[model samples]
Target: MARLPEPLTPLIQRTSIRQVGRILSNTQLSPFSMEMRISWNAPQTLPVPGQFFTILPCRYPLTLLRRPFAYSAVTESWFAFIYDIVGPATRDMAKLKAEDDADWIGPLGRGFPLPSPDVKPILVAGGAGVGPVFFLSNVLAGRGSAHLVVIGAREAKRLIRLEWPSHAEVRLCAEDGGTGITGTVIDGIGQQDMADKVFYSCGPAPMMAAVHRLAAECGCPSWVSVEEMMACGVGACQGCAVAAAGNGGPQEYKRICDEGPVFASGDLIW
Candidate 1:
């Protein structure tokens, strides 16, 4: 497994073994994406930004595997998940209504490390990856941290929008010239320097790899949230493992559901 940074150890230790969240609302963000807000009836452990949950819609018996979703936002009343309707499980999730019950297990895995008070934060998101990135922006803003959010999509119609906190400045990037910068997120970055910023990103692997390259070019440190498929959204299944750079030992694999969905940019073998 890639070596998760020492700072993440404490967060990993604080995760709950399991919990339940009740669905309060499920709204469509785009044709293929839906935003779900779930509330816990009794007090339960809540996830920090970058942490995720494994949810099984009670009605979808056909899909035994729970779906993983990063917490998109959290409030006193509920926490949210924004997911793409890519398959049977998620398509059924779109039919979920307010007050519906779903089996929720989590607040699991490691989250992004807290940033130093003096450093500026740069959040990058690609497509559905915006969920956790949005949550992180809110957390940083609440901490009085100044940050920039760069969001990307395939085209203008594919973009997702949200009310960003006042402390964050939002920039948009599009692969096609229909909106925002007419290029990939990295291309939209142009010649600006990021040497003083701390970077965090979640998205398709290729997009994140590009962000890592950008971080390297400006000599900045970065953290990334990885997405993997899992049968059990816990370490027991070992189904969501990824290769990591060998650190004075043989190559290893880490479970995305447990050790992380988040890791230092330098730690990954990719």
Candidate 2:
């Protein structure tokens, strides 16, 4: 991994129009990739690495509060969010343009804890799951931690390029072997004891599940971000819950909105 430089962490207190700004147009990173910059009206609080922010669409019934988007990257003035148009909420989000304000709130939820400074060769990310990890890597790179990236996708064409502060040595894996190694991402772990390092992942449920199992086998501490259908982005509604980390499991569901969009790999039923 190349060294990523760090910027100062910002202070966050609440959400307001003071924080939400119109889109400044978007950037096409790849044929399938898009990046958007929402203008922040003031010196918004910098999102600590691993933390996320919620964007309430510009409408009411706040119960459909807003979709929680991970803090892709943050600075003193503005922050960027990346998304693919997979459904209605995203389709609407994709249409946002410059000067068009959207309801926004956050710097919400805890992020993955940074790995110990003594540890390097940390495993990084792939695809949309890249959001929180990107923010985390930005902070870690600045401190000279080295990392390895094993990004997986169904095919090479589906992979998206991101601005990695450290730009760790990237490894690619695909189901079709269209690029890099062919097989599930866990194929990369090679049965090596991954103890002492951290594994951070976010993606489809099945993928995260497989990763959870792999992390356990390697004895690596892992973190994952859960994706669930949600109405209220905050804890009020019970729409987005998953099986719990406890013995009873989903018998006691964990709310994705309130309990977590992120969790320790062991604390989830999947």
Best by TM-score: 1
Top lDDT hit: 1
* CA displacement after TM-score superposition, residue 71 of candidate 1 (Å): 0.3
Which portions of model 1 miss their true places by more than 4 Å?
1-9, 17-20, 41-45
| Lowest summed lDDT window (length 10), candidate 2 | 1-10
lDDT string for model 2 (53-142, tens) is 677556332335467777777766678876666776676666666777776776665556566665554554556766666666776787
| Each candidate: RMSD | 3.1, 4.8
TM-score of each model, paired residue for residue = 0.92, 0.83
What does the lDDT read for residue 239 in candidate 2? 79
- The residue ranges of model 2 lying beyond 4 angstroms of the native Cα positions read 1-18, 41-45, 56-65, 124-126, 191-193, 248-250
Model 1 TM-score, all chains together: 0.92
For residues 98-217, write the lDDT of model 1, one tens digit per residue: 877788877778888867776777899987899999999998899898888999888877888888999998889888888888888887666765656778999899989998887877
Cα deviation at 61, candidate 2, in Å, is 11
